[model samples]
Target: MAKAYRKDEFEFFQNQVGKIDQRVKSYLEVAGFEKWTWVYAPVNRGRMMTSNLAECINGKLKQARELLIIEFLEEVSASSTHIYSIYDEGKKYIVCLDRSPFSCGRFQLDEITCERAITVLKNKHVVDMKPYCSEYYYPEILRKTYDQSMFPMPYKKEWIVPQEVIDEVVLPPKYKRQPGRPKKNRHKK
Candidate 1:
């Protein structure tokens, strides 16, 4: 029901859900169709139709999560023709290689070529995706960021502290730990 892009499609799924469980259907209705159903949504959600964005991202990062930080960074360092059509997971996506804003919304939002754009770029035999990325990620820009020399701090006794700052007392936060094994996974938002 959430994936349906047309009223008829949405209605069909809605009926199916109603048949399975009227209570679920009523709950969905009470929550508002616009909140969950694509057809009723007032704004474009792009290709992100999943119920939870964090879950979707977590799924995509499942493999990378096990890798070391440097290895993960290396993997992350790894877009497109004028336009192309892509089909994945029973959904069709339009990727615009020549400009900003692909159907997935990632290209425009992150200022980086998304997987769809990258596929289009590969099909078009285009190399060097650096041009598709934002200037912030450029080698020159990154180099400029740390061009200045960074010095280490002197001894604590050499520091000039403000009277108010020196007198201020900092306390640890009061937290009651739950009685159970600590969770290895991050808390979902």
Candidate 2:
């Protein structure tokens, strides 16, 4: 389960596990057996798709964790202090109401919410920025995303698997030998 699971392999594992215990299958069903990829929930997860992140953090914080609680907290705070500094410098933005989607390279969150957009708006004397940003970035959208309910899946015995899909044949791509002789030197565009 620690390894990155391919869809076909995961399905095979599910089928094998299904033959073992129904209770275990039920538990896995509730835990998103098919959709358990690490990238599914990326909020503040540091893009960690494996235990490598924990290993790296453990290594860096090992000495710090051994220190007194206050000292450890201070050390952690000191280590992350640099994140408060903004490195975006000499970047430009073209802010316009007519432009359907305004974009600035510096900000990942959104262009309209970035400092450059604010500066442009201030220069143009435009107030109330809610109209400038897309509705997709609105607070309501985030709230809705969090509010949705995802029901647990049924047990493996109850799972619906079509016979055609389960027995489908998959083949590797056909290899073709090029007519031209292989070049030793790399070609430049």
Candidate 2 C-alpha lDDT tens digits along 1-189: 322223344556667777898788788779874355422333322221232323434545678988999999887776542112223465333432333122332222232355655666666687877765656667888788889789999998999999998899999999998999987997889
Q: All models: lDDT?
A: 0.68, 0.52
Model 2 ranges off by over 4 Å: 1-92, 98-114, 122-127, 169-189
lDDT of 1 by residue, 2-109 (tens): 866456667899999999999999999999998876667766554333323344334445688788998776654431124467897787777654454456555443
Q: Pick the lDDT winner.
A: 1
Query: What lDDT score is found at residue 65 in candidate 2?
Result: 85
Error of 1 at 102 (Å): 1.7
* Per-model TM against the reference: 0.48, 0.33
Q: What TM-score should be assigned to candidate 2?
A: 0.33
Judged by whole-model lDDT over C-alpha atoms, candidate 2 comes out at: 0.52
